[model samples]
Target: MKTKKPTQSAKQAAVRYLSRRDHAEQELQQKLLARGFEQEEVDEAVALCQDYNWLDDARFAERLLNNGIAKGWGLLRIRQEMAHKGIHEEVVSHLFEDDEFDWFEHAREIAQRKYGDSPMDTDKEKARRLRFMQSKGFDFEQVKYALDVDDDEY
Candidate 1:
């Protein structure tokens, strides 16, 4: 028997997902598959979506980066979100590139915006702020720079 083509509903679901926001190919496929669509159908729908320029991982990844930065999220946090969404490392690297961006400066701005010129007077408060910065995904060095935490400060 001849192979069956992907159904219209699969294509419709793919478009509907894309209509809301950009989705990575793998993410879209997972969504469709989770919706009870067959693997073959999801595969074809994803391929069609790519062909129609409706699904673009690079665009999605870039949007994530821009949005994360706008929200004062650190590079690590943004990259983790992208990876969770199934975006490839190559796609992420394409947008991030090298050390052209000053992560420490960005982290510093976020820290200053929240803590201002007044330093946390207690070790407890300082630890809390450091934990918050870590949750925001900045590395130790960046967090230290952001908080201006010299050894004597502790």
Candidate 2:
């Protein structure tokens, strides 16, 4: 007689992955599939997770948004990241629709911390600062506001 090995079920794999952190439905689904689980099994596992409220895109989006804000990320960057993670557009938009957080103010604070209170003197210096802000996922308007805000305002 040959000894048989017990294989891990889709639910088992999914639960293990979820233990580490929250994951978007699509992200979890992809991860489960990549691990060599059958497509139907992966789908059933994902559906079960969703039914049990173990997988919530809204919750994931909220956590991601809050984390990005804490990290001083601009709205554009945060939005892009959430989208890439497969968060629903409605969830992303709803989180950003609140008027409590001021993106412009956030941009100014980030700029002050990065480049200090001193104004850029040369075009080259200004360009460099602009590039930095752009790389941070701020739009041109926010970047301009950040670069031009008076030091006395701080």
Candidate 3:
């Protein structure tokens, strides 16, 4: 297909999108294309946004990571959300490279917020809590840590 040449209007649209929130380049490209922009126009618009530091996937990823952590989301859920928003794996990976994040403590906090810190009285209750954490996208170890379930208990 013959793509139309780049245009200023596409860049304007890109800026409008960026003014609302930082966007991954791929996400901005797809939005512009969906709005009837040609591929070349979308590419130019994306590049223009990048040139102005308006659209940056790494920034988007970092904000997403921080937001997810604030919302008590596990790494799995955060990663999935970043991917869905067209964030690159490299960007996502870099955000997770920080070892200071205590995912276990975060999971435990989420658990306490949702289920309280009451000690489990039954094996069934422990399993149910474990399943709930898993549903929230926490890994097995983190979930166990949140519920304080020992390996021998399962």
- Local distance difference test scores for all models: 0.88, 0.84, 0.85
- Clashing residue pairs in candidate 1 are none
Please write out the lDDT profile of model 3 over residues 1-154, one tens digit for every residue.
Answer: 7656445589888998899988888888888887778788788888888888888888888898898888878989989989999998888887778758888999999999998868789878888888888877799999989888789988
C-alpha TM-score for every candidate: 0.89, 0.87, 0.89
The residue ranges of model 2 lying beyond 4 angstroms of the native Cα positions read 1-6, 149-154
**Model 1: worst 10 consecutive residues (lDDT sum):** 1-10
Cα RMSD to native, each candidate? Answer: 4.3, 5.3, 3.0
137: Cα error in model 1, Å: 0.8
Q: Tell me the number of clashing residue pairs for each predicted model.
A: 0, 0, 0
Model number with the top lDDT: 1
The 10-residue segment of model 2 with minimum total lDDT is 1-10
Q: Mark the regions of model 1 whose C-alpha exceeds 4 Å error after superposition.
A: 1-8, 151-154
Number of clashing pairs, model 1?
0
Model 1 TM-score on a 0 to 1 scale: 0.89
Give per-residue CA lDDT, model 1, range 1-154, as digits (tens). Answer: 4445445588898898899989988899888877778888888898898888888899999899888888989999999999999999999988887548789999999999988888688889899999999899899899999998886775
RMSD to native, candidate 1: 4.3
Please state the error at residue 1 of candidate 3 in Å: 16
Better of 1 and 2 by TM-score: 1
